[model samples]
Target: MALKFVRGQGDGQAESGEGQKADNTHSPDNKSKWLVNYKDRLYRLSYYTGVQLMRFGKRIRRHAVAAVLDAQDWLLEQSAETRERAAYARISLRRTLEQEFFSPVRAFRARVKELRAEYDSAKSQGGDQMESFLAATSQELWAETRKVLGITFNYVAPLGAAALLFVTITTVNSFSFGLKVEYNSKVVGYVRSEADFEVAQAEMKKRIIYEDYIQPEDAVPRFTMAIVNDKDIISTNDLTDRLIESSGNELQEAYGLYIDNQFMGATTDGDSLLENLNARLEEYSTGAKDEKVSFVKDVQVREGLYPLTSIVDLRNIESELDKDESEERIYTVQKGDAPTLIAQKYDMRYSDLKELNPEIETELFVGQEVLISRSVPFLGVQVTKTVTETEDIPYEIEQVTDNSYNEGFTKVSVKGQTGEKEVTSQITYVDGVETERIVLDSRVVKEPVTQKVIVGGNKPLSYIPTSGGTNNGGFIWPVGGNGGYVSCRIWGYSGHTGVDIASQPGTPIYAAAAGQVVTAQYWGGAYGHYVKISHGNGLYTLYAHNSKLYVNPGDYVEQGQLIAAMGRTGRATGNHCHFEIINNGRYLDPLQYVG
Candidate 1:
């Protein structure tokens, strides 16, 4: 065998190996012979192993190829069988659908088509018949309309012609002759109608003032029909002037004072009269710093012709303007109305009222007519002034809710006080009657202190009964069982003397404490069906607006005992209990006693 030299051999072992090598060198022939034999054996073993491995590999490869070919053939066979089965299934499905679904659908579609054809044919025939019927009806209606129109024309034509002829004749006659107006048998002028003559008379009456209904004899006019041309017809104004000229009075152009369009008096000097009127307004406006003064009635001066008899002396004009005129009006007396009160209502003296109403000599009765003079100044002046005065400012309430507090409990933490304010207003007075007042500006003299009120928002879950009785009396809610709440507070404002506990209609009401029933009856006024209980020590409780009362007067009831039912009666707006607590006839706040 071959000697192997290990790598980890010591130097001494290497030296021994060298010696052995030298010895081997000495037996080189024997070593060569052994090595060749070893080589040859090794080569034979290698060649045999390689041949065996090649043979095994070839056999394995051939088997694998055969297996692969078998698998491909099986796969192809399976694929062909699957394709055939799929084609057979597709053909069978098509035949099944054709027999079961498509055939029936086609038959139904054909039936529908036949029905549609029949419906269309019938519809076409109906349309034609309807069109023929409508055409025949339209022709008949047209014929009837023509016949009726022809008959109406035959009857109406003659009457229309007669009406036209009569209207034409009446119009021609109306335009033919005018009225000849003659004043005092002397011809004044010709007017188109008698209305113009009447207008002239009215104008003459207005322009001339008659004493004791005395008028000129010739002032009366006569109207006669006369043939006149268009140029001969005069207007109402022109006829009025002509009649005035022929009145045989000294007619001078003067300024006429018209008060509210009614002629008052005539003045020769218009400027002086207007100056006097302005002086009157300035005199009334003297004391007012910011004042607007004007006549209550529209006063105007116009230039016109007036008879001497109609003109008043200029000196007497001022007296006439200062005179007060009153219209005769009937006054019906009311019950409890005295003669003095009636006189005061009209701003007249009692003596003057008695003189005007002699029948009201003693006392005034209802429905009795009383006469009173309402003075109407001829020249009234209206003076509007801007006035400033101190006024009271109403205080406001500030509400604060506390959830910790029990519901239906209210306490005023700060008392409210009225403040002072200086207010400037524009006040208008017409003939001593206040017509309008408008606030112009306001300044606070003192700041108003807001009233702070704490209201409870928390509602108790249930009522906890108290142990005490009438001596140390305790009150409970009038509306038992969580059915009510304090809708309004006690003594909230003027006239509200109690608290309002809102509940359902017919809800049972309970007595606040043990007490003897004093009054239980329907008030018929504001209290409605009510109950009053008087507890010992001058204590009392009142319940109002009840639907039904369970306890009668003089009955005793315990605390939280049913006494009545809630309702909306008398002046109540809804179902609620108006509860009040009184001590010695003095009204007390219920919230102070009960929650």
Candidate 2:
């Protein structure tokens, strides 16, 4: 047996005696008697166990080492393959052992141990039975181990028969048995393999422990708040009183409701506070309405006048109306009011109000009444005037005489006189002497001199009729006269057609006839302080270059009623009214219509 062991160790050195000699130093002693005795016992035991036993034992040990090494090598091969497939698969052996094998070892341990026990028991049993049992056990072990190793093994013939039976049983068991895992009523992980089963079980256990140890009181709920409206409050009692007055409820119910010092609504307890308050507010709001009064104040005289040709009056009606009307209510001039005052009160255009009382004059009197209506129109104009006068002129006259000779053999002389004239002259004598003479002539031509003269002066003029016109009746010219000069004419350009009326700046432009205002605007585009009135005669009058307008869009206007004060506006060379008379969709010269 010692020789056999030595020979086994020296098998690679058979050709090198020197190598054998060197190995001998590390070898077990052969000369010692006890060593010899132990060797003899070992040899007898080997012989009694059968030559097959000795060979089988050596084979078993060799196979065991080879199996482990092969499993490791297979694992490495699988890792290399996995790496080639996906970069993330290049896991370390330690990680693989923990995740794929050790982690799942608990789930698979029972079967593995059973297989191992069966193998050991079969080895103890003798003959054909042992071979069959070992084969079955090895096959079972391989199946369990293959999951971790990613490899397979083969069995001998007799063993193969038993292995087939084991495989059948194992497959059936695998299909029938499974672990179920649940999380928060939802399934997140499934475990069919031992590795996966073990990991899931561990994770579940850890989560259970954490949940059991934590306290609910340690966590707090989150909250957020916001302020919807903020306003100053002068007094709580005042607010409460207002709420009570406006609300159809008692003081207790009205304690919390007010809108900017006015009573609005009532509030109940928290449940229906908003609902009740809103309802009360709606009722209060409905009660409020706007009331407009046609205000008139007499013109106050300051104890002097050239009949008071000019006067300044602040209407104060607008401010009063504004104050009397509810915030939610709109106040419009119904009748008998000046558009300028109404517009000033509302910060709107006089032209906008002009539609309400078209016959109203630009030169409004304190006692004259006009209408104020609801439709707030946008028509604003600014009036500005400048007056200038000519300086004093002087007059002068002179006289003159002339000398002449005619029809004489010896210097016959003649003289004649001409009518009133002024002249100065000088004559030269052949003796280097000079004579001076003067004459004057003056005569006023009284036969209605027919020389053309521009009729109107440069001073600004207005055409507002002073009498015989009202908001209802069509306007009658306040002053009797022919229409002013045809200073300019209307034409078409840039696909636009309109007329330009050249009058002195600050001319009072009136509504051509009874009409409703359709467009009233100031300072927008080419038309400045412009107004368009629809006369129902298939005619409309356009007035532009106004320093002021006195009507609104929807009000009825009478013919020849003052609508605006003419002045220089967009594209105007000087102060003049750009007037247009449209009849049947065609523009006629204002000169043709006005007269």
Candidate 3:
């Protein structure tokens, strides 16, 4: 590579020559052709530059194609080498496995074949020797066996007899001997062993509650070995019976009262005991002709042997039976449990809770026990009775419509009275709680009265009921014309709020009912001259577009009295009376009242 420096500004002599050339170019003739020359030169430069760029692109494409071909050839060579190396590796691995693992396996297989051949040969020769040896050994063994048999036969009968005698004696002893149970110096019975008597004693103790008998600690029996037959041996229950018999009149025969199959107590006189119990049951029965009473639990008397002290008196048994079934339940206080909360958890009243747990305090600690009161009767008496009672029959309501009053208005016309009826029913009660009721007979003594009520607002008809049929409603027609006719009703036209009564100008309009005048003025907007009358009971009447007003505000006007003169005074095409009925600031159809 060589380096060259081109002078940016030409030397002094060259600069003078370039300046002379520039001046020459700036002349008028040269200046006129300069742009044309510069454009031609620019075109030539662009054509040459494009040609050079094409050549450079052609060179780059050739090099890129050659590089790609070279890379492809290199990859092919590498893949072929990889295949060769993989084949070599595979062959080497096969050789390694054959030498290291399969060689030993094949050697062992050949050795096993040799050993098999040697064993087969040896077995063939040994089979003949074994047969001869077995023949000689069997004969010698038989000879010795016969000698031993002859010796054993000498004592066989004696030894067998001794064994049989020993077994027989051992079995007989097990069967013949038993424990003789003796209690209070008297023999009770014979049991297989003391264990049998112990079981019997345990059972006897269960019946010793309240009995005047020797305690188990004091009644410990003595056991002695004695010869007895198998039939003489007693069972545990039989031993218990013998022991009871040996009590020597300390026990007696009595009737045990069992309620619902559970033994309650024993009584000496069952007949008298039953009579008293029946009386107790009857005491709860209703003294009616068709009344029936019975015990809820099954009661029976079974005859059995019982200790004389175990016999309960009739009065005492009755008192025991009268006690409640359930024991008093106590609940343990838990965390976050208060006295009130504990009461609520058991569904008890606060007062009842306090009564049940008199020692309970307002604050409860965890693990503290609080008593809860709940009762369950041991015996319940179920009573069925047929009874009759007088009952009331409700009256029927009937509604009648009257358009003379406002909608939703109601008034009772007839007062109703409830009638009396006698009803007979079969009622069953258990422990004072009603369980069932069935109606037997019912008869009405008097029929119920039908109540009649007058309701407002219904389909319009020709007649409207009034206190007295003088006019349609409580008010008389305000305008006179035989009966005033309504031309345009309220809501008959758009924006029409009242009824228009067609009449001649200056025709007299009267007050519809007795009322005080609220307004009387020449209000010449929509109503030129009008009179408003306030009738009691939220009712008001407006006479609008009137020619003249006769009543002044605060002045009282009677029914049919002149209040205004009908005329086309304001917003009217012809002479007429615009009448409106208002109730509590609400516009009502005037025709509904007048017509």
Considering every candidate listed, which one attains the maximal lDDT?
Answer: 1
lDDT of 1 at 463: 31
Per-model TM-score versus the true fold: 0.34, 0.22, 0.31
- Please give the CA lDDT of all the candidate structures: 0.69, 0.41, 0.67
Candidate 3 backbone collisions, by pair: none
Off by over 4 Å in 3: 1-251, 307-309, 326-376, 433-435, 440-446, 458-595
Put down candidate 1 lDDT per residue, 180-225, tens digits, no spaces: 7677668888875544555555555566764222334654455566
At residue 482, give the lDDT of candidate 1: 72
- Model 3 lDDT tens row, 1-595: 1112111111111223333443343233555346534644564575578679879979999999999999878757787778798789999999986775566456556655665565566568898855665564566556645655554565477898999999996776465555676776778777655446545554344344566555332244565666688788766645655666665547777766767644577788888777766776777765888888877786766555667777888778888888998866879877767566777887878767766665454224578887785466787777888999999997766666587875434566887778999999999887776768899999999999986766555432222323342336655677765545678888886778898988776778988776566578875346778898766556788988787788765565677898888876655555678888787778877766674
Backbone clash total, candidate 1 = 0
Please list the Cα RMSD from the true structure of every candidate, rounded to 1 decimal place.
Answer: 55.4, 42.0, 45.3
Model 2 vs. true fold: TM: 0.22
Is candidate 1 or 3 superior in lDDT?
1
Ranking by lDDT: 1, 3, 2
